[model samples]
Target: MGTALEDSEIYQKFARITDSLLSPEIEDFKDSGGKVVGFFCSTVPEELFTAAGMLPFRMRGTGSTSTELADTCFTPINCTFPRHCFNQALEYEFEFLDALIVINSCDHIRRIYDNWIDQLDEPEMIHVMSLPRKTGDRQVDWYREEIAELKGKLEEHFGIEITDDAISDAIKLHNDVRRLQRELYELRKVDRPPITGAEVLRVMVAGTALPKADYREMLQELIGTVRGLEGNGDHKARVLVTGSQLDDPEFIELIEGQGALVVTDATCFGTRLMWRRIDEDEPDPIRAMAQYYVHDRPSCPRMHGDQPRRLDFLKELVEEFKVDGVIGERMNFCDIWQVEHFMTGGDLKEEGISFTQVDREYILAGKGQLQTRVQAFVETMKGTD
Candidate 1:
């Protein structure tokens, strides 16, 4: 797999970005007077920032492997994902952020936003938007209004007007990126996938880090490059991964190293980021962005009354990817996935999908244990086959 992508500059660039919290390309963009907005979740409408001519960077706790500094501000009871984010902030890894946005996705993340805003001095502009837990007409309307309000704030702070034409163009650009991402995933459906899951996760994380235009072109080129190549061997078992924040591609590599190829996943940073597209035909781009993110985007456990919807999506992925088994991976202290995984266990069993749950810290340190469990699971999957 490594040799296959060695000559591909697009794959190499994205892989480099995944290794750091901030990339040289982004620094160059900001250096050229482009405003960069740092956002936490996909719930934040990135099209708005791109339309406003600012770079929308999805905040990842990459580059830093320890939470030592973050522990001073937060407790051990808090999930390591957010804590690691704080750790990076304290280390000045996110000093390039001109503005930051956070959504009310979970208790720990909400608290992370609060702490960042109250504790940090950088990120001159900080905003927190409440993500409604339910789905409906009223919620959609409210979310649109919230998006409008955010747009207004951005306009006022940046002294730039985000025109309708700009938003329309931004939507088109983002939609193209989604289309390319979907096409990339389609290549995985083959018996021997050309690209590995670890590489896919790195590309997905890079998609959130760099500008849309840059990522879109790279994805297009990479897709063309990979399709012309042959698949790497050792695709012993097709597996689907689901769970908490998977910001690290090394985690995916660990599973792939265990001989099970991860064909697809339901992680927040993985498939959920690019599976859906915004409707461009809708005259109101803002309303379209708000509606799609709230209703049509991949279901998160935080969204109440969507458990069945999430399971249905999981089942569809299993069948679509020809997955032989499912791995329910979660962080140790993540309450949301803890319960969601417990409930999903039976639902997957009823469908006869081989499911296993493994909990670890956000920054995985137990590669030996994880590899052992993954090996056992791969053997079990082969036995079933």
Candidate 2:
């Protein structure tokens, strides 16, 4: 398992950005290419970037703040990811970046684009996009428009034109990935998912970091070897997880280890990005993309706080995924999720969803603590079965 931690120590250190740290990777990329764009989302449309031949990298926000670096550029009220990254960028930590793209996937992202555009002077092209949250024709049309608008932006900003063939080729690569991931998810539906939650997280993160073609192949190989029998678990428990900014996989591994699979989840890094992408032939990508945000299984703390909507989404997940219980994974210091954790936890209790809460951290070395929590939850969920 080439976990995220498998990388060099320097890379891991770089991943944790407080508002104070200067970002060398961000800066160096700028220096190398002179100008490149950043995509801040769980998913960026690979087709557009690949066709354009421009350097595109995913912005993985740690959601931690460095008060010294970020204080002047972002309001304290903003999300940590926005405050920290924007703070560093304003100080020229990302001077090499000529532009950035933000999709309307969450409140923090919307705020990030608005504040960033307002701060940067001429020559900075900030493209704010609307992402369609659901699947089908309405979605296809919206994503099509999004692709076109993005194409136009590339033309205007990079002085490079994106052709229809490029769009088609990009879509094909992404679609192949989509198909394989869907198959892999189906394999996970079994009693024993071959790849661990940590592994799954790695694959998903690579979805952002690696090229689409490589990621799909890696997943296909990893998912093929079913982990065989689960060493833990009471043999039964439906599990549901709710959280925000969940790019890490330690917690997911814990719950899965305990004898239950994470059939359903509500997190910023999961389905919110997983289910969304732009295809080649969608006529109106922007409209399709915009509606995806409103119509999909809305994520907590980000969407409207209507208690019923929260419960409905949870209940539906439980039923569809056949979950036995629910787990809310909060990071040790994630303020946004800390609040949502309570709201979602309370409503879940009211609706009679068996559940537990764990405050997890991002440090990759502590696998033992994670395994313990997961074992206990699985045992609890099994409940004398």
Candidate 3:
């Protein structure tokens, strides 16, 4: 018989949400007169949208199978993630979104904003945010001002006044989400976790798709159920996955299928977004958000001069989760992560860690090759033991 956690209604809901681009919750939210604002990157403070009575959606190219339409605008050298995203937009896959806020995370991603405005018709309220390349006092201040500008734009577009009190309330609400996710991650620290890495990825992706309050409630239920169940002791090695925008659960499933359990990850869609909490007590909510998003949280490769900090955080996860090997997966032609993986591979080797890099498309493909590599890596680790 399966465990209660495996058969839970909430777990099923998470899978259903992740399997599609527009989930039932999103359709219901829209039907009830709620506006949804899709944002490209994690750097965008979601609290602002929540405070302004809008749903903040973390945009992904989940269901995209081809970049046919987007190919006319973009070259083959660009990352496929953004190509698939733009393809989805061109196909009217994201027509439900009332607005889109793009961030200059990279040249390819920033191009989406331009292409979107030129092509799309329904989502008239499109905005672009300039993200700082490095972290510093000046950058923090600059981000804070940028956030304020976003707030002003929301107010102007929606005719809604987002008060400081409302932003504070939103911060508290999102912080609750961060706390619950962290608690869920803590469960993975055990030798035999009740939950699998694929399931955790589904839950994390669902959080980005659904309403915050609803997602939080489901997470609390999931954590409670999974905590009581006996852990699964059916894996050969524990692996830590880290790299570029991985929102697909099947990729983790592929790795796990090769006799390795993906215990944890440092990907943007996973730990990077949930690892840190914003200050609830800070008087200036915008400044607090800017500080947390820009400075405090785990920095992605786009942030210059932060590779050392990123490596330190990855090493800490390896120790905490008892990771056997680290797999660094990056999308093809991702210049930033290509450099990051090269640096990380050498650095991790110097620390006496097992590391391998995998280059893949935005959509999951080449499973046989990936499986062969993963199986060899797992067997190599077993041999070392």
Candidate 4:
């Protein structure tokens, strides 16, 4: 799998999508007069956007390695992840975005949305929705209403109706993407998976950034190539990384370079995005998307009262992937995950899993310190082995 993917043109395209905000594929899509809707968090019901005859692009600060432009509008005290994305927008990097839909998943992101409206003139349309912090029957209903409202806004703004058939098709398309991603992860169930964690992260990012149909085809091709490959399994340990927004492949490479294989990650761009598929059987596809996004999706720290659910998912990944330890990292100034680290770390301890937590800026620095810690964790896992 590794050999085939390294040689595949599709894999190179996926890698390029990860390194750039708008890939040539997307640029061409926009140039053809396609509507592109940019979104920030997973909480947004993207299937709705897709069904609305618009392309949903996950906004990231991938190319903006520096926050110099963002710092002018937002102080250093804000979370760097959103700031970095804002910096990219300020530089007209995301000029192709026709509209933006933001969710209040965290304070930092919400503030960035506010600044985006106030300071930016591109993205002719923008909408902010409040994500319910709880997962319950009533919360699901509330989210369903929120999704309906978003659909209405898009319909009015674009003068297009998102009919049931369009939504049903979108649901199936997204589910197919999730199914292929899960199959890719299942390859890592082997002691030494054919692909590396950095590769997995890149594929996941590509799924979000590229056109769904195009990504789905590329993924199917990659999966078949991976299934026939064999891994040496010579790494010191198999690790699972959980964190606040880990879109950068370089950070995963840095950790893997420490003689550990990152088999699975529980971050937003990782398992959280791929774990669940929308309920196609539901009479109304809109309600199905709402249910899946609010209840069935992987729980983030922001989902209050879902710590147990989150832990169970992590434990499942640890057991399934043969993880030696878990890395809990939070973006610097991300208070939500910062508080979650203690709770999650304690639970992992009781379950007899080794856990380590670290804080990082949006773009990583202090590589020497990070490598030392990961190397120590690798040694610990190796000693136990």
Q: Please give each candidate's TM-score.
A: 0.97, 0.66, 0.97, 0.97
Task: Choose 3 or 4, whichever is better by lDDT.
Answer: 3
Work out candidate 4's RMSD over C-alphas. Answer: 1.6
**All models, RMSD in angstroms:** 1.4, 6.6, 1.5, 1.6
lDDT of candidate 3 over 1-385, digit per residue (tens): 1235657888999989988889889999999999999999888999898888788898899889999999999898989999999998888889889889999999999999888888778687898998898899899999999999999998999888999999999999998998999999999989988988888999999988888888899999989888888998778899999986899989988988887888889998888888998998889999999999889999899999999999999999999999998999999988898899999989998999899988899889999999999998998887634
Model 2: per-residue lDDT, tens digit, 1-385?
A: 2333334332233233211222444355445564456777653464567567554556654333354565575565555555656665665656545567888766666777777777777337878877665444566576667766887888887798877666566666765776665565555555544434444455555555444554566556544443332322334564667776666565565565665666657665555455444434555433333344344435445443444666677777677666777888775555656776687678777877776777764433367876777678777656545
Question: Among these predicted structures, which one has the highest lDDT?
Answer: 3
lDDT of candidates 1 onward, in order: 0.87, 0.58, 0.90, 0.86
1-385 per-residue lDDT for model 1 (tens digits): 3648756887899889878877899989988998889988778999999998888988878877799988887888998889988899988889999999988888888887878877789888898898888878788889999999999999998888999899999999998998888898999999988998998888888888888998898888888888987887676799999986788888888898888898899987777877888889989999998888888888888888899999999999999999999999988788889889889978998999999988888887888999989999988879645
**Residue 147: error of model 1 in Å?**
0.8
Better of 2 and 3 by lDDT: 3
Question: In model 1, which runs have C-alpha deviations exceeding 4 angstroms?
Answer: 1-3
> How far does residue 341 in candidate 1 sit from its true spot (Å)?
1.0
Q: Could you tell me how far off, in angstroms, the CA of residue 214 lies in candidate 2 after the best superposition?
A: 3.2
In order, how many clashes per candidate?
0, 28, 0, 1
Ranking by TM-score: 3, 1, 4, 2
Candidate 3 root-mean-square deviation in Å: 1.5
Worst 10 residues of 1 by lDDT: 1-10
**What lDDT score goes with residue 265 in model 3?**
92
Candidate 2 to truth, TM: 0.66
Candidate 4, pairs of clashing residues = 1-229
Q: Whole-model lDDT for model 4 versus the true structure?
A: 0.86
lDDT, candidate 1, at 25 = 90
